[model samples]
Target: IRILPHVHDTGAFFVALLEKVSPLPGEKIYKEKDAEEREAGESGSETQRVRQPPKKKQRTGFKEEPYFYFEKDEPIWPGISQFYDMNPEVDPTHFLSRTNDGKKRNLYFTNKLVKDVVTLNQDHIKIINTGVKVLVRSDNKGADCDFRLAQEGSQVLLPLFKKRKISITRDDMVTMLLNDDMCEPPEIEKMDTKTQEQCENLESGSLAFTHKREDGVEITLVGWKGAKSVRGYVAKHDRIHYLRLLNADTSKYEKNKYQEQRDLLQKNGSIDDNNENSNEILAENGTTKNDDLENGNITEVKENEIKNNENVDNEDNGNGNGDRNGNDHEMEINKQTG
Candidate 1:
């Protein structure tokens, strides 16, 4: 049997139940038109009716009246964390790991996910029964935001971003991505200034390498903003590119020092046999020489020796052929004389 409840926006409620009970002889079935006419006749002001509209009842061999009522609890002011947990359908693609003082542990969905919760303003968001109350307020004056995760039994509230439109739960941001819609929220200047600064501080003019794979390709992007660091990203498919950028200032300093040493060596006079021997000694002890000639000389010498040996072998073969021809002519002369 169906039980229809009459719910008012305020703290009044009534329930109509379907049962096999018979009505008394003098009692008449309730009609919505009768109630409306009675309400019009009784009051002219709309302010007098705070209750919700009356629902029509079906005649199903049952006595129907106000069966039960209960008071309703006031809705709580939602925290940012409560917005994420209440909605089961929310997408968790970009999860963020937040740490405090390098030791405190806190994990939460990315700002992309939190923005959706704040946008939908679901009423059912509540704290979880077993997990830690994930909500923590930022201590920084600039970060005057409160965070909270939803508990299991909480009901969604009205949509925070809309005017007077109610939302029972947070909307999934992944659905927006799947639909090829941009899910990024409008940028708040004050809130995002620090992040923008960090992105800007990344050094420019670093090496970027592109790698191709069967499914998708990944590009390694490296830029030095300050200190050297490495990062990796999978742009497409499962392929990822690892990137490392040198510390710009430190690298420049090392280059200048090497240039100064080279200038000093050039000023001291051209590299002589003594200096070459010293360089070879240094190279043997792990230092590398900058001269290309020193590295290629051994291969060039071997090629020259091979070419000379081929020439000498050809000359010897030519002399042996001349002697054989001379011997054949001498025998012919002997035969002619005999």
Candidate 2:
């Protein structure tokens, strides 16, 4: 039957084992060395080795041996005359094992397989077989006290203990760490005086007014409440008006009649004294004309009365003569007698 070998660097003796053996009846089965014997042998102590038990016959076609052991550097193979040392108490399942000498431990793979184990002493240790180069780190004091076993050309990760919570995913933290612009805050724009006035003039409790210039151009402004009155007429060249409301007493309408009369007289070129004298002369002329008319009427009345008295006397004489003529001849004799 063919035998296969598996070898690895463990900084100790390279050990190999074989299993699945067939043995004859009443023949002794192979046995490997126990830990006590191996320890005695390593120390060069001479002692009687224990003998193996003979194999017993079984109903099966062949009986299997438990295991057969061999050391690679040693020249023995399948030789059952002497027993090979084996560490029964040692846990083969572990990646590392301590030697029987108790001076050091051997890596199951290699010293480098265990990370972060620095070499503390050089003479106390040995490297048997390794897949890669082994680096021996030494301090200046020449007494190394630590051992670092790891894969060759591989990085070692040190154990780190953090005492505080770290922010790993916050956007702000990431931005700040990266020194990016994402952490900058937006800027606010400032308002100018004109803009502020316009805003104040807005219907939202803002004071504002419009002013007209001499060229008829208009401008609006905002001011404090009750600061100034905005009611006034603009002059021809003025751009603003400032009329205000106030309480003032009003007077009644009056006519200057005396002044009017004086003006009329002046226009006519006449004085008050000249006008009075002219009116008096006119009155005198009217009185003289009325007296003359009265005198003429009295003289006509006297002439008419004289004419009437003459007529009356003539009538009386005529009547007396008639009577005398009728009685003249008769009355002569009577008259002579009387």
Candidate 3:
């Protein structure tokens, strides 16, 4: 085996091919005993012993409930189909549930091929899961439909939906996506006039929000309407994906802790540089000479004291000259009298 180089940041893998070089002697394939021989062996009537084949054991995990596809007469299908104004081509039988009882909390949808596979091989194989969740049981009293459209299946059903869909503008889409708050979603009043009119008549339930761009790129999102506000039903990652398609900001949701830490360190480094420059300036200004850095008039007081000392020194020099002259004159008079 040779290791393959990583491509596009994918994990490295290895590839090898094996071929049979030599053939082994053919062995006779054994077959199971016939029903009569097995019955005779069990009844102890056979003179020759006929070995019976081992019985196949049922898989313990096969006890799981099989998918129960919805029928045309299914009660839940009518309300959902009518509320969304589903196209005639869309089949209600494709939807299924885990429970056969009247109560189904979630409805899943599978394509014809998957449905056939599940139905045909259910007894032979164990199917863990299949299909996308299309509807959830939300018994909202105010809403006409008891089920809400799931985000995972919205794209599959969007083309077939007619009534509950609203065409929104870029601003409207951005506004809805920006409001991440679930408790208080974006209000209808904050949306555009056209969007407001579209949502005004809508009942409080899941609906589709579509936006077409000038570049011919169309975006669709699963949204919910309420009595007071409207919100998108997208998961966090899916919300980021839709926001990217609309060219809206997704930085709020896509946070990088390492980038944040780098930014914080850079900010702190700048502050430290500023502090160092400030310290150097204070040192040059001789502020460290005195502890009272907060003193406002310290420099002015020092200058004033220096000037006063100069004036006192000049006064003392003049008085000493006058006294010397007075004493010399007195000595001169005494010498003349002697």
lDDT, candidate 2, residue 154?
18
Cα lDDT tens digits for candidate 1, 1-338: 33454475444455666686888897555534356667668644333334555898744432321111111221222322243223434333323233322422232333454545533532334312212222222222211122221211111221111111111101111111111101121121322344334434433211122233344532222111112221111111111112111111222122464675555444334334356654433322221221222111111123345557667897887853777889999999999999
Kindly list the per-residue Cα lDDT of model 3 for residues 152-215, writing each as its tens digit. 7887777777899899999888877776533346778978999989988877777788899899
Ranking by lDDT: 3, 1, 2
Candidate with top lDDT is: 3
Ranking by TM-score: 3, 1, 2
Candidate with top TM-score is: 3
Runs of candidate 2 with Cα error greater than 4 angstroms are: 1-95, 108-140, 153-338
Give the lDDT of residue 312 in candidate 2. 80
TM agreement with the true structure for every prediction: 0.14, 0.12, 0.59
Every candidate's lDDT: 0.29, 0.28, 0.71
RMSD of candidates 1 onward, in order: 31.4, 69.7, 25.0
Q: What lDDT would candidate 1 get against the real structure?
A: 0.29
**Model 3, which residues run further than 4 Å from truth?**
1-56, 60-63, 256-338
Q: What is the RMSD, in Å, between candidate 2 and the native fold over all Cα?
A: 69.7
TM-score of 1: 0.14
Instruction: List runs of model 1 lying over 4 Å from the truth.
Output: 1-77, 81-88, 91-105, 108-138, 144-338
After TM-score superposition, the amount by which residue 272's alpha carbon in candidate 2 deviates from its true location, in angstroms, is 99
